[model samples]
Target: MSTKLNRIDLNLLVYLDALLRERNVTQAAHQLNLSQPAMSNGLRRLRDLFDDPLLVRTSDGMTPTERALELEPQVREVLMNIEQAVQPRSAFAPEQAQRVFRIMASDYAESTLLPAVLGKLRVQAPGLTLDIMTPSDVSFLDVERGKVDMVINRFDSMPQSFHQIHLWNDSFSCLLSPENPVLADFTLENYLQAKHIWVSKTGMGVGVGVDPDDVQRLGWVDSALARLGKKR
Candidate 1:
């Protein structure tokens, strides 16, 4: 707190950590492979920077002062974070890995895609955890921030920065009772004329074109009808 950030020596943190752990100036110097005099100079600089006698002489030996004890865990944690930042990530092996993956999926995909996904995980990565969430529960911001790992569904549009892939080509079917009169004609005109049920749809991802009045997004069947300037 006493020294300006630009004027303080970052190396003092290493010296202070070693000194606190070893509790002896000569021992701390030996741990850092530095001479006793150099270590003492570092302790002086640290004291001036923090305006605290971080370590005080004791009857038995050197002991950390109250301030040094407070800084001990914080300093170790900072050093650990720096080491992790500089280290290369270890190669991942599914069989040995323990990780959590967050996925946003629609009900349709829950029935179709998740079974195989769970099967693979059960066989290869038993230790991994999957948190499958409905599309309504998350947003693109979650994906950008790594809170959500992936979204599986149709995308009307997406940000240019997103990495995308075509999982598979799929088709849809409309069911009707065999005795229905529409079975006699089975044409687009007849189908449009028939009263139909509108089930709620989801997993369309985040898009501006999804508004109900957008015409192009009025569900697959209605969107086709809209292209012909028609509505069911």
Candidate 2:
């Protein structure tokens, strides 16, 4: 018989499971700590709802009907699933746990920062594993959907939806040979006058993404230069 989900009493499934397992009203009531009459009432409701005898009297004992036999295992499985669903989760014990954590980070973060974090995890969470992916390989959509556990990188801007923390302050340092003439007078004027190569991607991918030509997506140095009425 067709049944509307909202019309069904889910608790009846528990009563039905106990009834089918016990195969006798008195025994089923004992199993559930209910009176014999209460179990009998439950049986009446089950019979009415399913429109089946569900059980029958036989000389040997109470026997399950063909329909009841078919339902027995299915009912048992459903009860087991419900039991698990309601069970409270145990607190994490990292020393006794094994799990994989996924991380998405930029190349700069991967090289400069992640090594220390990995070193500590190796000692404290010996069974824990990390799956590292670069920013260029993954989109913010992956992070929003929880496919990536964490992201560690510099950002010119981030979505208000993303929970952010300030890790540390960083700045651009010029790497030049000792003989380089720029080092003679390393003032803002000398630095800007010298030819330079700008290499930064933190501002390239904003949220889901943006066009590479979008000057509004410029990185820290370029943005700072723009504020000072200059271009990098």
Candidate 3:
């Protein structure tokens, strides 16, 4: 296997992976940012190297051959392992590094955590740039494709493939105007009677003390409320 690998250009494996995923010459070319002719040449080289028509044209689109299907997972794993193995091992010199950091975060994180992160980056990595994006439904896909470097979110569940850290603990608190009547006579009845506002981007009804519906959307807040036998 090592001898055979020695004869192959490692980049072809990357191209092959992209081709198998896309199953279209043009789409694979776009993925690798190569010209159509260049991608065709790569496909030709791959066919010569493997002695297989890895992809066959079908009415719907390009279809992978049985050999290509069998090789997909192995090729992806090999490329991923190689990527990790070759990644920088030396201490990161944020002060000297010139790179762009892409982050996917929520609006709440944008208002809270991003300012602090930007402050630190200004001092530590003057040359570094940040591209902070509001997360979408496909944000995890972006992370998987390497378009997003990190995501700051409060998820109910996370994929096992990701590395995560708990940044801080937070609790929800109700804020009322100082002059509000509730301030003078704050009681459970007053709290229950008071009109409330829920700020949600998705227009979902807000939970009073802890919204059970938010358990899947808002991380641990609901669990904390459950511990106290409270529901809003």
Q: Best candidate per lDDT, number? A: 1
The per-model lDDT (C-alpha) reads 0.81, 0.77, 0.79
Which lDDT tens digits does candidate 2 get at residues 108-200?
888888899889888888899989998877776566434677888877677566778888888777787798798888988888788765444
Query: Please, what is the TM-score per model?
Result: 0.56, 0.53, 0.62
CA lDDT of 117 in candidate 1? 86
Q: Model 3, range 1-232, lDDT digits (tens) per residue?
A: 7998789999999999889867799999999999999999999999999899999898988988899877876786688889989998889889999999888888888888889888998998889998888766445645655567899878877766678999877767888889889988888668756766656666554464546466545444446655666544
CA RMSD of all predictions = 15.0, 17.2, 6.1
Would you list the rank order by lDDT, best first?
1, 3, 2
- Model 1, span 170-214: residue lDDT tens: 887879999999999899889888877656456352243356576
- Strongest candidate by TM-score: 3
TM-score of 1: 0.56
